[model samples]
Target: IKRLLVEVQHVKNMKEKERKRKVEEKKDNRRWIETQREREKLEKIKGINTKKYRKTKKDIERKRKKHTKEEIEKTELERRWNKEKKSEIKKQSDRNK
Candidate 1:
């Protein structure tokens, strides 16, 4: 009878251990699911605002330089025009002699 009791107690202990293991596995799965949901939400929001995001300083400076190229070209053209006008006036004064 003592042997039978011991066998039964051993079986019960194994079952309790299996139950605890299953519970831990369920908790791990739930945590994994929660983390996946959070990441999905973050990705969705990031996607929505991707174009509106601020650039790093380096990126901002690079873009600034890119946009200024045309403006610099325009200013150079204006400077050349003013220089030509002044030369034309000097030539007119010389011809008046």
Candidate 2:
């Protein structure tokens, strides 16, 4: 009877150890899941920031192109005005002579 009681106690101890191991495993899994969720959230935020950066870069490029176009138009208009003034001055000098 004493030997039987010892065997029963050993079995109970083994079951307790197994239960503790399963509980620890569950905790580890929960921690891993939380970490994965955080990592995905950070990745999503990074993606959004990257998209915003690209949009800002494109806007700056568009503005630069528009400014250059306006500058070219302004210079062309000045050139035409100068040419008209020169022609008018020449015509007046010829009439005077």
Candidate 3:
């Protein structure tokens, strides 16, 4: 009878240990799921930030192209004015001679 009691107590202890291990496993699974959710959220935010960065880069490039076009136009006008002035000076000198 005493041996039977010892065996029964041993079985109970084994079941209790199994139950504790299962509980710890469940807690670990919950923590893993939470971390995965956080990682996904951060990835989504990063995607949005990259899109905004690309848009700003395109805007800056467009502005730079417009500025270069304006500079070209101004230089063209100055060159034409200089040519007209030179021709007028040549004509006046020929008349004086």
Candidate 4:
């Protein structure tokens, strides 16, 4: 049971790391998208709507893809709950022993 809790902890760590990485990636993407949109707006005001501008707009849209905050929080909770459950099981098993 101790070993099981160890495994659960490892899984939780892996999931949290993934969540953090994804959050960082989403933030980077948002920044890039906002920057691109700002540059495009500036170019449009300057009367320079080129193909590159269109491409950048499309790229901005692609960057808009992201997981909801609720989803991220749910996954994080699951990670914690699973680890806690393992610990609980260990306690029960020890009590039985």
lDDT tens per residue, model 2, 19-51: 999999999999999998887678666755656
List ranges where model 1 is wrong by over 4 Å: 48-97
List where candidate 3 sits over 4 angstroms from the true fold. 48-97
TM-score of each: 0.47, 0.48, 0.48, 0.47
lDDT of 1 by residue, 5-67 (tens): 999999999999999999999999999999988876786666544433334445778989988
TM-score of 2: 0.48
**Weakest lDDT window of 10 consecutive positions for candidate 1:** 48-57
lDDT winner between 1 and 4, please give it: 4
- Give the per-residue Cα lDDT of candidate 3 at 30: 100
What is candidate 2's local distance difference test score?
0.91
Q: Ten-residue segment with the worst summed lDDT in candidate 3?
A: 44-53
TM-score for model 3? 0.48
Candidate 4 clashes between residue pairs 3 or more apart in a chain or in different chains: none
| Best-first order by TM-score | 2, 3, 1, 4
